[model samples]
Every structure is written in C-alpha cells, then in structure tokens.
Target chain A: MPSDVSAPVSNGKPGRLRRLIAARAEGEALRKGNLLVLAVLLLVAVVALLPFYWMLSSSLRMPDQMFANPVQWIPNPINWASYPEAWGAQNFGRYFFNSSVVAVLITLGNLLFCSLAAYSLTKFRFRGRHLSFMLILSTMMLPLEITMVPLFLIVNSFGWTNSYQGLVVPFLVEGFGVFLMRQYMLSIPTDVIEAARIDGASELRIFWMIVMPLCKPALVALAIFTFREAWDLYIWPLVIITDDALRTLPLGISLFMSGYGTAWDQVMAIAVLGTLPMALLFFFLQRAFIQGIAGTGLK
Target chain B: MSPVSSSRSARPGPASSGPKTPGRRPWLTPGSKQTAFAWAILLPALLILAIFRFLPMLEAFYLSFTDYDLISPPRWVGLQNFIDLTQDPLFLKSVQVSLIYVSCSVIPVIPLSLGLAILFNRALLARNFLRSAIFMPVVMPAVVMAVVWTFMYQQDGVMNTILGWVGIDPVPWLRSSSTALWSVIMIGIWRAVPYYMVIFLAGLQAIPRDYYDAAKIDGAGSWATFRYITLPLLKPTMLLVVVMNVIVAMKVFAVPMIMTGGGPGDATRVLPLFIYQTAFEFFDMGKASAMSVVMFAILMAFAFIQVRLFTRKEEQ
Candidate 1:
C-alpha cells in the first residue's frame, strides 16, 4: 500500500546514515501522533455503532427482559423467536416485496433514462441545450413542499392514489442522475463515439453498445443511490398513499410503532428488520456506496 | 430541491458542417432541430419535473393566498393565509423552532465531522471498519432511527438506565416540553454527523501528503501543520458540508414526527410537520400551502446564496 516503498536510506554513507536516524525519529513521532488519533477514532466508532449493537443485543433477548433494571449487555437466555414473530406479525414479507419492487424499478428507470439523457447531451448538437439543462438544475431549488399541492392534485386527477405508478413513475426521471451521468460521460473519450459513428452505428446503438458498457461504475452508483432513496422515501409516499397495504418499509416500520403503541421489543425487532437489506447492501458493497458519494462530487 | 442544473449533461455537441458551409449549419446549432435527439432523451425527466415539481410550485403559491379546505373549493381570499400565519403563535414558534433546529444541527456538524474525519484519516488500524461503522447511520432510515431513539430516551429507557449508574436523576427526554426539542436536536446531530464525516474523509484524502511532509521538514509541529495547512485547504469542503447539512436539517420531519409527534405541547413542532398537521390533520390546504410557500422561499434564499458563494469561490 506504500506509495514509495524504498527504505529510509537507499544509500547508507555516513551523512546518509545520520539523516536516516533523524528521519526515523520523525517517523516515530508521527506514528505516535497517529496512534493517539487512532485511539480517539476508535472511541468515536464505538460510540457511533453502540445503537446498532444495542439493537442487535436487545433483539435477541426475551421480550420481558428488554428493560430489565440495570440492563445487561448479555441477557441470561437468548431468545430468537422475536425475529420470526415480528416478521410474521408486521406483514414484513409484503413490505419487503413492496420495498424491493419500488427500489428496483426506480434504479432501473434512473439507469436507463439518465444515461439516454446523458448520451444525447454529450453526443448531440442541439439548440437551447444549455437552457434545457438550466431548467433541470432549477428544479433542484424548488422545495418539495411547494410542489406537494400540485403533485397531489395531479396524482388524484390520474386516480393514482394508493397505486405503485403514483409512487414510482413521478420519480423515474431524476435530475441528479442525469447530472451525474453527464459529468461521467464528459470524461469519456469522444474518439470512441466517433469510431462507432464511422461504423454507421445509430445513436441508440452507440449508447447501448459503447457508452453503456463503459458506464458500469456510474450506473452501479446510481442504482445504489436510487434504491436507497426509494427505499427510505417517507413524506411524499405518506401524503399520497393512505392504504394500509401500500406503505413502504419506512412507513411500515413507523406504523408498527403507532399501531401497537411502541412495544420496545416489537419496535426494535421491526427496526432491525427494516434496516437489514440496506445494511447488508452496505456491508457487501460499501465500496459502491462510497464510490457513489464520491462520484457525485457532493462530498 | 432546486431546479435540475444539468448543464453538463445537456451541453450541445459542436456543429457539424463542411468547411464550405462556414458556420451555416443551422440545423447543428444548439436548441434547434438537430438537437431534438438530446431533448428527446431529457423529455421524460423534463415532463415529470413540469408536472410533479414545477406545476405544484405554482399551485402552492396560488393556494397560499386563498382560504381552501380540501373538501371545499379554494376561495380567493388574498393574503388571508399569510395574515393567519403572522397572527398564529404556533406558526411563529414553529419558525423559531425550525431555525433552532437548523442552527443547532448545522453549526456543530462541521467541527465534529472534521475532528472525526481527521482521526479516521490518521488512524492506521481498523480504518475501514471504523469508517463503515460511522457511516452506518447515514443509510439507516430516519423513521427507524426515530423509533429506536424514542425507546432509548424513554424514562426507563437505556439512556436513563446509563444515567442511573452515574447517580443522575431520570430525565424525561421526548416527553417533557422543555427538553423535547433539544432531545430531537441530539438525534439530528447523531444522525447527521456521520454523513458529513464521510464527506470530510473524502476531502481529507484529497489533501496531498507532500504538503504535510513539507510542513514536517520545516520542523512544524502537528498543531501548526493542521492549522496552517489542513484547515485552509479544507475550507471549501467545510463550507459545502455546512450548507448541505443545513438544507437537510431544515427538512427534518420523520425524526421528530415519530419521536415526539411535535410534542408534549408543540415544543418540537417544525415547519414540515407543522405543514403536515395543518394540511392533512386539519384539512386546511390553504394555510398549509402558505407555510409551504414560506418554507420554499427560505430554502430558495439559502440555496441561491449558497450556490452563489460556492460558484464565486470556484471562480476565485
């Protein structure tokens, strides 16, 4: 992992030897400082992860043992039934299917449309191009609150209330996705497209056969982001859809608390369940999530 | 959300013309017939934005001036909702509470994230694990966090249980009107800091090691190097993090809603929840639209100023 792997003293003459000792002293001090930083960082990490740990620990405990006075980190007897019971009681299978469908649809929609828009913008010569782009950017400034009334009206007019189309279609075209794809495509060498053009490849053919193949990383990043956003969306879904069967994971988890009036065990169980898919996604492809964030250049 | 500034994506390709044509390929000019393909690609997003985003904005602005209940047709009563907002004590308090929430969440996040990121950057062991752990909360749904946090802050909850070990009396967290807002603020911080830290970590990585090495060669101490070199370069990132944090904090709703329902007595009510209550719970769409317009204005002002500042800095 070292950027330059040569030893402190590649040439060990007398003066070089003395300088090496001095450099070693500096290295020692730097390591010492880094150790202090590492200790503090580990402390913060523990604090940051404490809730997850507690949630996991509590989830495995007997229901009655959850709030036992002088709470023990390790309960006397572990209980695993809470997982299955909570899953059964909360209609989690249905919620999971709903979340999965929404997330997947949104991801697919974003990947397809965003790349097409990106391709056209990067590869075509069109009028008012900048204005169209500016219009897209301008939408980012409008708070969702301002759009709520009209959106609600339009959805109602379409009779899309309590329907998946209402939830998914409006979000299929994301400005951010278009923006990210454009930025990435800007970096793609124009020669490839010209070569494809010389071969008489159509625009759609070039996009699919050439650009899309090269945009895998950006597409993966966009997919992860769209999935997470769709999975966690709360307010709009809450406002538009009222049917008990139509709630997303977030709404479903919250409903568990409100309906049963906050049974600590049940809430914890559901929270853990709700967090599982995304958490596993993070665990396995943390690289993709980090890449997604960095690729967006927002960080 | 701001308008989709997708300039990079929608930039027109260079004109295609023979040398003889000499800038006369009018078809190839941007925003003309030739670029219809690009516009076609952008069409779906543009259509959705028009219908779902922009149309509602205009409608909301129109509604804010009237006295419309959802059941009854909106009646034109110009500025009544605004007047009602001005006179409404709860609305005033909500505005104040929202400001407090934004200020509290935004102010502390930068320094906290910087400190955390610097530590993580310097750490040699368990670096990846620690980073993932810190960033875990960022992806956790806010509703889940609220549910779990509400449990932890209960009178006999885990937090008070820990407090008991320190001989501190049990403190009502979300239940007490006075403490509820602050409690929500803590959750906001806890939930928010990790995201900012991830950003700061990326910024930290971008800082070239040669600068630190040069500072070291000059016999500069750790603090001097950090103050003189690190802080200055990180300023741009710090500004970005603060602006984004404030924007996210301003939209905070699910956290407070699930945790306290805006209170023991409206103590925790902020604008979004307030808007929800006004529009849905009370069925007063007009008054709700007024609050929405106010929120839209505040956010727009913030975004405009922020984008200007960001672009200005970039230009410099």
Candidate 2:
C-alpha cells in the first residue's frame, strides 16, 4: 500500500477496492500515454521525411509516371535514367563542380581564419579586444536581406560580380563562425597554452600544434556549418551570378525549374542531387551537427 | 568577459617564456607586444568583415538617402523616398504581409517545437533514429525545400490527396490569395520547428535530472512539474528561439519567391522580396534602400529589446 504513491495502493486506506482499480487504471493509462507520444512523434517524422522520400521516388520515376493519380509513393521499376539525363539536361555537372569548389574553399578558409581569430581573442588580453569582439558580434544582427543590395554593389564595384570572388569571399569569415569558435575555445584551459609558451613554442606553432588538435570536434562542427551555408548560397549568387558558368547549385536548380518547368522528373533529380551533399554531411557528422547546434543554443 | 580575469588565467608566466634571449628580449613579455600579436592574428578576418559586412551595412544607411541605380552618379533625395513610401500601397501591403507572415510562422512554431523537444527528451524507443528523421527537414537545402513543397501544394497534389482521404475537399494551397501567405508560413514551420526542437532538447538536457527527481518525491503531477520546472528553466533557450524565428521569418524570401512568386496579387510579397524587386528588378535603388532602412529599424528594435531583457534577467 505504501509502495505506490501515484495511485495510493490501499491496504486499509479508504476506498480500498477503488484504490486497487485506480492503480490498474493508472498502469493502463501510462501505457496509453507512451503509445500516444510514440504515435505523435511517428507522425511528425513521417511528415518531415515524406518530402525527401517523395523527391527520391520521383527522381527514379519516368516522366509519365510522376504526375500519375493516386500519387506514386514508390517507382515501380525504379528507373535510373533520370540521374544521367538530368545531369546532361543542363550544365549540372559544371554546377556541381562549381558549388563543391566554392563550398570547400569557404569552409577551409573559415576553419583556418576563424580559429586563429577566436583563439587569439579568447587567450590574449589586448587593447580593444573587447571592442573588436563587440564589432564582430554586432554584424550578426544585420540580416543579409537588408544588406543584400549594398553588398551586391560593393562586390560589383570590385568587379567581382559573376566570379568566384563574388560567391566565396563575402562569406569567408562569418561572425557566427568567429563566435562559435571563441565560445568553444573558452573551454580550453589556458594552462596548456602557457606550458607551450614556456617550452619556447612560437605562437603560431602553439596554435597549429596544440590548440588546433584539441579543437577538432569544434572544428568539425564549424566546418560542417560553414560548408552548409556556403552550399546554400542562393540569394547572393542569384543577385550577382548572371553567368551560366558560375552558377552554384541553388541558382542552377532554380534556373532548371524555370527553364524546364514541366520536367518534374528532372527537377526532382536535381533537387535530390542538391540535397545529398548536405544530407550526407549530416549523416557522417551527425554528432558534430547536433553538437554545433546545441553549442549555439547553450552558450 | 572582463580583462582582469582573462589576463590572469591566460597570460603565460612571461618571465619564464622569454628565457630564450638576453637584454634584447626581456624576461617578461610586455602587454603591448601581446596586443600587437593579437591584432596581427585577428587582422585578416577583421579586414574581410570590415570590407564585406560592416561597410555594406553602413552603405545601406548612406545609400538610402541617395537616388543611385549603379548607372548614374548619386543624387541626394533626402527623405523623399521615405515620404513617398507612406503613400505607396504596395510597400504598405508588403509591411502588413511581412508582419503577418512573421507572426504566423513564429507563434505556432514556438509551442510546437518546445513540445516536441520535451517529448523526445525522455528515454524513449528509437530515440536517435526518430530524432534524425524529424531533423531531416532542417538539413534539406532551402531551394530544394521550396521546390518540393511546391510539388506537394499543387491543387491535385499530395496535400490535397491526403486531405481527400480524410473526407475533406481539396484546398488550393499556393494558388489562392488568401492561402498563399499561410501556405508559405506552413512550410516555414515545417522546416523551422525541428531545428528549434533541437535547441530546446539541448536546453531540456541541460536541466539537472535531480530537479525532476525532487518533484517526483513531492508527488507533483506532470503538468505541474513542467509548468513550474521546465518552462521557467527553458527561458533563455525560449528567448533565443523566439528572437531567431522572428528574424528568420522577417527575411523569408526564397520560399515565397519560388512557391508563390508573391502571386495571387501580392499575398506573399514580404518586405525583403519587395526590397529585392525595387533594387534589382525595377532599378529603383533609392526606394529599395528606404524600404531596407525601415526593415532594419524594426529588426534592430526587436533585437535591442530582447538583448536588454536578457541582460536584465541575468542581473537579477
């Protein structure tokens, strides 16, 4: 009777019969609650994944079978022709290559430059260091949408429009990247850095040898975040890159949609193609991905 | 964040670290030398941000006053653009539409995401797999998301097909003026909810399990526990999610642009989209910059208030 506090098991407690019934009912109710929670989560997961499933299934379907009634959830024969056809239908190969180079370079640049800056800011007590960090923090508040036209003009003035400079340089060292790195670096004990210094290691050597190695998890998270943002460069590329040669994947996909409005099979193929790099990155780096997000939330 | 504490812990025993040289390099490194080194290391990134981000942000302010369209030299119009916007119906409509869109996307997104995060925070079956499944939407490319949603929202599309099975008539999601803004908001929620859920899940995990154990000993109901314990403790994360969602919703461009093209007569023509058309498509940089100024002011006010509120909470 004293064991279960939830339903108040009744040895001599008032309403003994009712108490026993209530405990049994509470057990049943608990089971039902678990089932209900699972059901709700299942529904949400389905909704989240349905689009990916639909896009992949459509990418494998023939053109005629795409718009068929009853909504083809799975392609019957799983036609693989759309992959090549969509690749060749437009300059998707070029687009893929361009996006890859831009994304990777920007990611590498952020890793090297942001980590250097963050490490220095967190480790050193210097003049205007606080001011410098504050200046960087302030930029995060200004939406790229508000600054888009002016940023475009700035790039245009430098003769960077329609070039890699336009696509990559404007985003190379992000405020958010700097912030993330600095937050992560704050956890690193200064004792280690001091020991390195006493051992006559140069500052650069200390950073490269000691600090960078210890910061691998944070670096992986930053690399993935930076890569995803660079890969998703849509509005800026759309504004600046009017040339077919420099079109990134998102721009390329939009152009594909506009140019081939009726080609759902090909459109879905390109959509799936555009999503896989990011999706695969998420798959391999799921831990860092979640950690990156959680880090931003927590600190 | 104060200099004293950071310097105390971070500064090497400069006297020992400088043992390599005689009088030329003293036994203790000077503070100015460290400042110089910090500036040198930080210079490249600072230079990039100064030229790209900070400069452009200022340019948005200065350019708002001038009538320049990349062709002719600047002509100062000095508040005329702002004055004209007061009478411009389309600009006015965009402000309304943007507010509605932002509000709609954020209000429902907060509760839904937090609730989902709470559900998954427990020790449950298939936890990681279900999390990855739910989080799949946030990782999908925005362009890809908009395109696929366009597919599902077609009049006879999957949305209606599913609705039909529920004994409901097909609803034209993207085609009608009344539903276009809401449809865009729905997709915004679809993508945003899971992302914020992860943030809330992190917040929930951070709460010590001992608090919940204490509540159990006190015989508190689940609702009482959550209301008093979980909700208050999640305040910081909640504030972040709310502010971020608001800002993101204000800048909703590619989705409505691709989904509806602000179609059915400006139903989804949000402020950012309007600014785009004014600056690029129509080549009216003055008016566009003015619109951006208005948008910036509103965002700044929201951000300023939230930050102040957060700092006040910390002080208490």
Name the best candidate (by DockQ): 1
Cα lDDT of model 1 by residue, B1-316, tens digit: 1123133333344422211122211221244443666677778777877787778888988888888877788899998889989999999999999989988888888789888877766425666777788788877878888888888898878889878989999999898998899999998898778877776766666666678879988999879999889987877777767666776788888888888889989999999999988887898888999999999878877777777876776666
lDDT of 2 at B162: 89
Which ranges in model 2 have alpha carbons more than 4 Å from their true place?
Answer: A1-31, B1-30, B308-316
Worst 10 residues of 2 chain B by lDDT: B18-27
Task: Give the alpha carbon lDDT tens digit for every residue of A1-299 in model 1.
Answer: 11111111012255335534554676877677767777787787777787887887877888787788769789569887777777777767877788788888988998998888766765565566566666776776665655666678778899999999998888887777887777566656666776776788866687789889888877877888778878878888888888878778888888888986545666688889888988999988886776565445432
Local error of candidate 1 at B148, Å? 0.8
lDDT agreement with native, every candidate: 0.75, 0.81
Give the TM-score of chain A, superposed on the true chain A, for all candidates in the order listed: 0.88, 0.87
How well does each candidate superpose onto the true structure, as a TM-score? Answer: 0.88, 0.89
**Which regions of candidate 1 deviate over 4 angstroms?**
A1-25, B1-34, B215-224, B304-316
Name the top lDDT candidate: 2
Residues B1-316 of candidate 2: C-alpha lDDT, one tens digit per residue: 3454445435564322221222222212336766677789899889999998889888888888899877898799898889999999999999999989887889999999999988876545677788889989989989999998887787767789889899999998899998888888998999999889887887777666678879979999999999889988888788888888888889988888887778879999999999998998998888888899999988888778878987787677
